[model samples]
Target: MDTSRLLRTTGTVLAAAGLLLSGCTTSGSAQRASASAGGATGSGAAHAAPAVPEEPSAALRPYYAQKLRWRECGVPGFECATMKAPLDYAHPSSGQDVELAVARKKATGPGKRLGSLVVNPGGPGGSGIGYLQAYAGIGYPAQVRARYDMVSIDPRGVARSSPVECLTGPRMDAYTQVDQTPDDAAEQAKLVEAFKEFAAGCQERSRRVLPHVSTVEAARDLDLLRGVLGDEKLTYVGASYGTLLGATYADLFPGRAGRLVLDGAMDPTRSAIDLNRDQTAGFETAFRSFARDCAKQAECPLGRGNTDQVAQRLRDFFRTLDAKPVPTGEPARPLGEALATTGVIAALYDESAWPQLREAITQAMDGDGAGLLSLADSYYEREPDGSYANLMYANAAVNCLDQPPAFTGPAAVTAAVPSFEKASPVFGAGFAWASLNCAYWPAKATGTAHRLEAKGAPPIVVVGTTRDPATPYKWAQGLAGQLDSGVLLTYDGDGHTAYGRGSDCIDTAINRYLLEGTTPAAGKKC
Candidate 1:
């Protein structure tokens, strides 16, 4: 089916088995704030601007001064804690609070303790705690993990952090199958209704949480984590959309910024439509790379034709599925175009999934749709029992709040089709339509496109993969150029993220920064 939209735009990678245990909570206690380190740029070069205030404003100081009570989580060597932040930063005394879920693995201590190193795998909705326990804690360099406590905070309205809920399993199933590429007025109306219903469900079930889950608010939450942990400044490693969160934190607290590594960076200056269009083109670039690899395989699903001919063949397959779905072994769940497209797009996140995609597509072409349906299920985080995780729900909530809708309605999307199609001939129309999901959001947009200079912040490393399907590499270059103290670290590779991916150059550059606070030289490429 015609799934061209990259799902990484929504969900983070799933936690490995046995890492979803609930964190135990305790009352917070007071702690003295650590003394700030003055202008310790990795390169020892002076910043273009002066450092910001070491202390927050009187209103925000309380949040920065609060402490957390850590208790043992089920996971070995990990402690879980709950930190409180204002539901509305504008009115901290409103007596309203959002409880954030946090987890940490203390440094093993072969080297001098470097303090906490917070990590986030981006989703706008991904479980930071899950990522910490499953991946970063165990997968990060032993040297880095031995010195700095690996930490994570599930952003507000994500995972255990007051997660936003939307449509029920059955309703969501129907919603996923709704035709994104509307061919007629009736179909377009149906698509609009599905979006409206989804938005309405979020508002109905999560009204109190929906309005405050923006990236700016989440960044504010990160500051609270920093203060409670008794850290002098924020030392962070953020991947994908997590980079956006880290950049926002840098923008808000430049002086308190420590060593920051933003892998798979997003340019904060783009409008919502531009982000979608650029991402659409990114997926096309990634697809061509995948297509070229597939063409050399013994059992290429798209045939041995040139890249353009193969893309057209895949497009034709999606069109065929749009008109007629095939049974995917699940009696009630036939494999339709929308689901198939999502299935295909999900595999584009990392090259390792390429063989799986080829096999899934080959199976689908042979009238067996189960394999592709499974891929789509994985993309949506749909459980075997038909329930769905809050990934998509929180993704839409945070995304809708962070910026205005890319399109006001189907008409706007229709008007933009030519440009989007020009960006990506095979998958452009579906993604352009998908961008309309936020148009019917219940809350008014709370943010806008702006440059994140993070002026005077300590040197921040921005890593970009050359063929990343979600955040394009150019966005990294643009973000690095925008930040006054940004350092560019280009990973001349594929995949959504760069670090800890078997690259000695990338890992060494990042590890040095995280451990020794040494930033890579500008324009360093792996």
Candidate 2:
């Protein structure tokens, strides 16, 4: 597979898991308007409102004034709301409103309510509200849930709100198949063409929405939500890319910070290129862990040997697929490097998925690519009916807007390939180059890399998994170090984030903090 396709696949998977839950809804229009007008007076009373710079445009003023009415939704204890935010923060008066989907499950315990606890599953584009309703809202420790009203909001350009859609199902299907690791000049040209096509499609389909769907803008919009939620201080738990969003919020509104927990944290100081390279190396580390475990298993494909050799073998398989893809169950859809890499990347997120990855690879080696393809399909969030979610589009838009592209073109990618290869030997070159996708983005970035230092914020917890691949453990260390009042909690294990992925020690530490305003030691390791 070519680099672009790999990026599209990875971006798609991350975005889908990140923001799949929230979306725009038409049913709550009247309620939204009434809530906004009714609650405007008390919205800023929870906390000292940040200075509203100048008069906001009439268009954005209404959204800022809007109050979210927590009405009963599908979940038994949770209430949902639809709020509005400005499309462009710079031109807040533009009158172009983007909807934000929100959900909250009220506390059930007898203790006095501490406040709302907002949570996010990272993807720069992840749906905060969706995660709250699906997992965190109901599954969080009963003790923590008892003291806080669990809350979440779908950021701009994400699902359950006004989503930033770029392509139709058919167009996205075609986009996903484009190769990323081109072998020759012709293949390289094909890769460039694929990027152009994807960019052009997004531009044509989402011209109005693309430019405004940036992380910085999303952070500002979050402040608006914080105000509307009537919280004196913003309490949040963010994972993966959500960490970046949370940190951004702290940077933009330090005074509003409350009990924040950033799990599977991201380092805001790294450049896009550096972040990508580090992530590539992290994946290699995770793959080595998988290889070590697989070699002990009876069904090991690469056999019992050095992990380096297993990695090389996997690379060789990818090279072979680059030349000729194998047949999957679907006749028109052959399993190529992009799909194979995606399958591997999916497993790297959680060690629990390692066994499944081993089985998938063993099946692929046996000429049945169905298992691997299924893993890849799950990562991409591909529906059984040949439809796709809008995750990739939103991910690209948010990532591209958060920082500039790592590389400008194929030449830059070629130069970086060797270094990338050195990082992972298996996924390095491809992932390294995959970081360049934003170079062809249709919109300019609205944010830049900057350190987050929430100096006046209350004690915040930052969790790190020692062997996390998606968001490396070092990122957690860095983010914790950067935050003025950050308390580091380490989970000496494998996985993307640490809160609910079955670590009793880790969960207890976080729950204690959330329920009683107690923080773990600065460097407590589980």
Candidate 3:
């Protein structure tokens, strides 16, 4: 899941349901995806850096000056609009432009309008508009919502923004079951073959949209949104991968940057392999937290054993499933090691899902894997009707483009196994192999590891959770140190992002920043 690009919106605790994935995946609502904004870091200048433009170039100015024609969407109070951006920023007049999907809930003023606050629930692929409609508009602090129009944009190659499509439901289903932690050459070949097929599918289906879906391009789209919405500068809150997008936005548009919050941030300085290892360790840390809590429960599935024992038991269970996949109630869609791993990994995003993970693992160990299978389905954004959302396709598209492959081939993965396992003994092997997914990508790497300062940008707030599983806490420290005006707000807690999750201290501080343009002190911890 490199899930350093954490599934923020998918795991978001929704108002009508426990998690958005519970409702967002229905065929009835395609734009309903990013309500779960997810992570931090002072980030980068990849590729020696393009000279920062002091002003929008003449070609780009047209994109910046364009206006949006808002119309009512299916969701009440939310207005939908489509905005245009060049398909390639380097060549704006290429005659190819991307139409982005946007949605906003106008400010419900109690005093005066403060303008728009754009949010992204960090999928790189997740639906920002969906997030705005499902939660941000209603769940954000009342005062904040009252003064600012809650806004979201479906970045190009994401849901409702000409989403990147790949394999059909059935092919994707087969792809998910292929062995990731291969024990033999044959199995390893099959794993690589699956990745090849997935990449090939994306290339075949989304040739035009695939190359332009990088994070840099998405950040450019955010600036475009800022212009059309009439905002003088970008005011944003980005979660998980969204944090990277926001950081990149600030880096690209320093002068145009306003109040920005990057929660559960990614360190742009990290290479793809480093990110995979860091996230692998992060999940292990989170799993230990879940393990400690689970072991104290009377219904604990792994018994009252220590974390190592429990982790061993889980790994053993995965091995058993590898040889004999269990029926998931749906005869055609049985549960295998890959699916079970994804199921468990999905639950690691938020602690609230720990109970569900406990029950699912219990059911899987008892030979009925339907519960675990369902969790895996949710992680992949597979709908009830066997169709899948564009989440994974866009995830891969953006990820592969954002950095070079984690491994070049099976030999490379084999060599890296020891280091990855050292990082996370419980899930390292799988994470290591999963990193191989991008190795076979069709696109050449368009970006590289670099540090971002966003020099001259206004004070930008960076939030980090100490025990965040998908994005580690140290990333926050790194991101804060990198930004010239970065302010660090630490949540000494667990789960993904800090704000709107639970802690009042975290919420109050962020609210002050968003509402009054107040920056938290240099080192504020919740």
In candidate 3, position 74 carries an lDDT of 98
Residue-level lDDT tens digits of model 3 in 1-526: 2232334633344221245321000000000011001001112224224324656777778898887899999988999989988887767777899889999999998969988999998876788887888778888889999999999998899889988999999998888888888999999998888889999999999999887787767777787788788888888998877887888778767888999999887777777888888888988999999999999999989889999888888888988998998888888778888889888888877778889999989999888999888878877778889998898888888888777787899999999999999999888998899888878888776666777778888999999999988778887788888887999999998787877888999999999998888899989998
63-90: candidate 2 lDDT, tens digit per residue = 6677787798886877999888766565
Residue 126's lDDT within candidate 1 is 77
The lDDT per prediction is: 0.78, 0.70, 0.79
What lDDT tens digits, residue by residue, belong to model 1 across residues 1-526?
A: 2122122422235222111111100000000001012211122111122323567657667777777788998999999988888887656667899999999999998989999999987777778887887778988899999999999999899989999999999999999899998998999999999999999999999999888787767877888889889998999998878888888788768988999998888887777888888888888988998898999988999998789988998999999999998999887788888998887777777777788889989999999998888878877778999998887888888777766778898999999998999999988989889889879999877556666788778899999889988888998998898888999899887667788877899999999988878889978999
**What is the lDDT, from 0 to 100, of the residue 213 in candidate 3?**
80
**Reference-based TM-score, model 2:** 0.88
**Residue 465, candidate 2: alpha-carbon lDDT:** 82
